[model samples]
Target: MVSVASPVRQSESRGSIEPILAVTAPDMKRVNDLILAMAGSNVALIPEIAEHLIASGGKRLRPMLTIASAIACGYTGEAHVKLAASVEFMHTATLLHDDVVDESDLRRGSKTARTIWGNQASVLVGDFLLGQAFKMMVEVGSLTALAILSSASAVIAEGEVWQLSAAKRMTTSEADYLAVIDAKTAALFAAAAEVGPVVAGSPEPVRAAMRDYGRSLGLAFQLVDDALDYGGSAADLGKNTGDDFREGKLTLPVILAYQAGNDEERAFWQGAMEGGRNDDAALLRATALMRRHGTLEATIERARHYGEKAREAAASLPRSPSREALLSVVDFCIDRVS
Candidate 1:
């Protein structure tokens, strides 16, 4: 069990995202330099919107995944640096676009770029970053790495559209939910880790191992975020608590809760979800329902299952510091709930 000791400090920031910061510090700086250089535009609004979100308090975990995966697979070239920057740019662009789609104001505890600059600017800047990301991928001159990331980009878009269709629909199933997140979130993670081995020309077994690890880790990360959005303080979640509820997004917690609930409980869920009720009282009732049904606890247990998959995926890799760090990353993802 996670000790509730130091709850204030623990909830203030993400502990899992903080650990490898030291090990990846130097490489992260290089990635940042590349990002800054590539983000520059003659048009003033482009840089403003891009930098606003980029400079915000995100963990940069995805790019670090790319870097760490490459290092673990024993890469020793400058290409991974550019790929890391590319991964970050893709992620930032997605955030810019996502804020617009979600109509969210706060992101990473700050006003989103779209909130400050408006949706038009946010979208255009996101496109600009995507263009820059492709340019970097081309510059790296690796077809395998390029294919992995490019396909992931397409899959992420598809996932978002699928989620858009599924939003707040009472009929949305767990299988549908998993499919959405696998495309939307986990694709890049799998690509991020696999591209490392691709860049390193590692054997197929190692490449497959890294891909599995990253995909599982990404699922755990997102699932933890889902749980936190309901049970956590606003400080624990960079975004406001119940933002997902307010947004009418159907995450695993609510999906499971709805499925397990009875006639009256199902009626409550339908009214709240379909009617778009997002008040504090409604949220209290929702939390009470989740607690009573044990859905919240069940969701966390599901996350632990994925975390175990991540660990098992790494079991066959040749032991190294990078491998150990990647393993710890899984625990860190799970530990965010603490």
Candidate 2:
């Protein structure tokens, strides 16, 4: 496994990210405006669903990755705004469809688009946003950029299908879990960071560096999110606690927990994964078992390890405000609550 300098003390606290908020403050309003502008021109009905989902207030991390990577690679193009918005739209589109597949009701403490707008509307609107993303990509007119995003989308689709097929299969391994995350979560993040330099016509090595940096960061980000399902407060993390467990989706934390468990702990997991019958008490019992086995801490340590790797990946970049921003974002990933 790739490692880095001993993990830095987490700079941004979980649940309350004052430091990242400070870094993002300058770009926040403009980025929101750009995202709004991107969503405005969709067909009338689609725009309503799109706005409902977009207005639900994500941290806008994907677009932030795009703009920050562009600036870090020394790009001064205005197109970064549209590129960033395009990335956000793709991400939002995925989330809309994801909620439908997962049957998720609450996201960021609000009713999901599928919950409020119905699944059909949510799914159709998600397709519309995806079309819009491709339209924006064609507008940028970079064959390379189109290739990167197309491959990323393909990987993401594969990951989603893999997860669906792998559910409740005891054959699932850590390798399988990592494969799913790499495809589902890390692919787009890698694209978001790589596309910036591609847009700037950056050197090959620099573009490669940004892609590596974002991939590591994305892995770290997803690890923390999976871990938080058992350990995080719903009020703080902005989702229902232990929702993954309820859905019978095996994440890294659960995989590690199962590996390190004693007979009773293992039995509990077997029961939980059986036919997806996850009672509240059973999930709470499993959470307690995970804590006792230190599985959650081990999962967190792995995430921190990757966060450090992300920082190291970007360390060779020329120092600039964008470099600082990227480093801070690495810190932010491991530290964020949701």
Best by lDDT: 1
Query: Can you list the residue pairs that collide in candidate 2?
Result: none
Expressed as tens digits, the lDDT of each residue in 1-338 for candidate 1 is 12212331223433355546766788889999999999999998887777788888777888888888888788889898899899999999898899899999998789988888899988989999999999999999999999999999999999999999998898899889988999999998888888988999999998999899989988887888888888776666678878888887899989999999999988888878888876788888888888777777777777778988999998778888777778878888877777
Candidate 2: tens digits of C-alpha lDDT, residues 69-187:
77777777676776777788889988998999999999888888888779998998888788878888888888898899888988999999999998866558988888899899999
- Could you estimate the TM-score for every candidate? 0.94, 0.90
Q: How accurate is candidate 1 locally (lDDT)?
A: 0.84
After TM-score superposition, the amount by which residue 1's alpha carbon in candidate 2 deviates from its true location, in angstroms, is 31
Model 2: per-residue Cα lDDT at residue 147? 94
TM-score of 1: 0.94
lDDT of each: 0.84, 0.79
